[model samples]
Target: MRIVKVMSVVLCSLGIAFAAMAKDMNVGFVYVSPIGDAGYSFAHDKGRLAVEEMDGVKTAYVESVKEGPDSERVILNMARKGYDIIFATSFGYMDPMLKVAKQFPNTVFMHCSGFKKAENMSNYFGRMYQARYLSGMVAGAMTKSKILGYVAAFPIPEVIRGINAFTLGAQAVNPEVSVRVVWTKTWYDPATEKEAAKSLLDAGADVIAQHQDSPGPQEAAQEKGVYSIGYNSDMSTFAPKSHLTAPVWNWAPYYKQIVNQVKEGTWKAESAWPGMDAGIVKLAPFGPMVPQDVQDTVTAKQTEIASGAFKVFSGPVKDQQGAVKIADGTVANDETLLGMTWFVEGVVGTTE
Candidate 1:
């Protein structure tokens, strides 16, 4: 009888230890593209790596997830597997993530570059347009043709806003500068992006800027001996000769903060759109070809932006039709920026 009681006590202790071990949080990540060495997915994967290093957290990720029903299946499977927090890191995953969040009320779903939200889901993105503006300053000063090319992924508001900000910044420096845009629709197609850049280069564009994930446009510029600005991450390594600065994302701090909030059971669904002031969006280092005066100008403007003394979308803004959009001395609010559907003056492309 005594031996049997001792065995029961040991078994109970083992069960308790197993329960404690299971308490570790399981975090899952869904990526829209392959996490290559650089670009949008790479930037977010860096954040995932950082969060995985924290104690008592186990991380899992599925890369190259399509943004449709396939993504919904993957997300649902992750939730079913007992993932505590899931991050769908793509704009197209918004609806799917929301649907999964509804079915799994206990799991937390965070969607990047999206607007929808549920009780267990939240949206987050940076004001990347601010950084795009800074990079445009470099493009405007370096371009001899006063004609810039933008290789874009989609015609969504995010891409539209970035293009507008880039045009505004270039015009701020060189009034005669005009921006030409080509939409590839796909976010991470290198061949298509390179072809689009070459087409722009053939059309007298001396400077190329891109919103696509790959360094294809930068590579094309280097081959043609032209300048280019990059997006998502620093792409100078891919085209050292023609590389200018890029708009970069720093998502590690935000990821760690969200993980901690979820761990503490204090996380709430909120729309987070942080910018330069929060270190969420920033400019990569300028290339050697950038003149000192231009660098100084961009730096001064960046400082003003960080201090909230300057607004990128401030008034006297106009559409392509020469009609005034925002009156003089006025500023566009978050609502106006989020719902942007028209091209600003100096843009040479259709938003359709």
Candidate 2:
């Protein structure tokens, strides 16, 4: 009887230990749009779900938080609630996140697609331009009008770099192709974005690509019977007939890495820009309309990119004014790419 009682006591102690360990970690995410938007925030929410799968870790998120003061309030509240790690997934949240990090030294902060950092804050973004360039190759091959339209969110370096890369890739496949840009200035407004796509369609664009958070552009392309490329996630389901491909984010791997680092006590504040090689970004599968030849060519280029054998921003790259931005035999470095504020030669748009 005494031996059985001692065994029960040992089991009770193990249960208490397990409960303590389970309460050790809490992670929070702040999103600029609702997860149902099926775009950028949806992709980030997938990453948060991945983090939740880890043992002894719990995750929570507040979505549709505006980028300015709303973001700052949400982040500060999460920190105050004892969230060990907070991820603010939007470019405009950079300054606000930096402000919050100063007050919470023990909490880890990660901002997406931004350039600012603090002692307890880090910034991260995927090299999505590489995949965008590949999608442009597909659009260039299929376009009969040789004119592609882009629905852009903002004129920040991230959007500008993607436009330049897409243009370069299209030009590589079809040197005669040109891209037109229309800015919506709002990230998740469907009506404005669809109107922008319609304007591009009216301007004789046979193919449309977008750096936006809504499927509105895709819907516009479909209604017009034109081809389109998507962003942030695979949007084929929205416009299967029109979607040729997309440059998508796979944040699970990177998010898991960060969570593991924090749990292991080895995390530090640094900028992380993982690319195709790291499986952080990729080109979505081709639609049925994409010819086998085009698919094969894109796949070959994707392989080269993944192996680091080909750099997307290799020069003799020219600006919209026919002036050289990157000389021949030179590959554009991260600093140049990060601060890009001008369009490439084949693009028709004002940076402002």
Candidate 3:
């Protein structure tokens, strides 16, 4: 009886040790908005959920984190709590995340929509502009007015890329169309976004589009009796009647890929440049307001691009001043697009 009791105690200790080793893959995420907001941060949180669903991985997140020093504080807190991998999901978290990566050499850190990397840190973002460009094509074909309104935040390259791609797509269908841009310089300011949309409407823009992370712009479109293109996530729920479609970035596949690598001991600091081809960037369902023909045309074009038979930026392209930016017969590559800071002809706004 004494021998059996000793054996049982030894078995219990061994079981506890095995469990501890098996639970080593704890991952953490930080977001700028509430997970339930149904917008930008919500999409990223969903990606984290998908990672959690993976066997042998534990995922956790801290939402509503601020941009600067406070963001660093949150990341450091996660590290202190024994998280093995940390994902900071905001452009503003770039510097802070890099700082923390230096401080925590053993922790693997990833920042979304940022361009800095270290041995312990890496950046990842999708070419959501591909989807945005397709939506713009639909907008051009659908809009009766040649004047399109763009509600945007800061004139950063990330935002500028979408505007340019959307403009290019719109021009593909309606050469006479003009995209009017208004900057809110904020990510989720409802009041600012609404007012920006109103200002664009007041300027005779009949179709609305936005790069901010609020449903306020869509709400403004609904009230003004115009159509809208949403961003980051599908916000048709906010303006079912006026919503057109959205360019959504599905991070789940990428999240799962990363977690699997960590589990298999092959996780490396690499950039994720997923597009329509890889199913990372996609157009949300067309709203009830979209015409069937418009949907067909958009989907066809998307398919062509995905299959590599079509090149959206293959150009005979010229800047606003008629200077050729991309020479005829040349396709603009990722590096060129990333450094782009010019507006094509007929786009009305300064890139400040």
Best by the TM-score measure? 2
Candidate 1 — worst ten consecutive residues by lDDT sum? 12-21
User: Which structure is stronger by TM-score: 1 or 3?
Assistant: 1
* Tens digits of per-residue lDDT for model 2, 183-294: 9998899889999999999999999999999999999999999999999999999999999999999999999898877766567688999999999999988999999999
- Stretches off by above 4 angstroms in model 1 are 1-22
On lDDT, the candidate that comes out on top is 2
Q: lDDT score, residue 33, model 2?
A: 90
* Range of the 10 consecutive residues with the lowest summed lDDT in candidate 2: 12-21
Tens-digit lDDT track of model 3 for 1-352: 9999777545543433343356767889999878876678888987888888877788888988889999999999997787778999999999999988887656678999988887667899998888988989977876777899999888888898899889999999899999999999887778999999999999988889998878898999889898998887889999998889989878999988876665555666767777899888899899887888888889999999889888777888888888998899999998888878888776898898
TM-score for each candidate, following the candidate numbering: 0.93, 0.94, 0.92
Model with the higher TM-score, candidate 2 or 3: 2
User: What TM value does model 2 have?
Assistant: 0.94
Superposition error at 268 for model 2 (Å)? 0.9
- Misplaced by over 4 Å in model 2 are 1-22
lDDT for model 2 comes to 0.91
Residue 293 accuracy (lDDT) in model 1 = 97
Give the clashing pairs for model 1.
none
Alpha carbon lDDT of each predicted model: 0.91, 0.91, 0.84
Residue 121 lDDT in candidate 1: 84
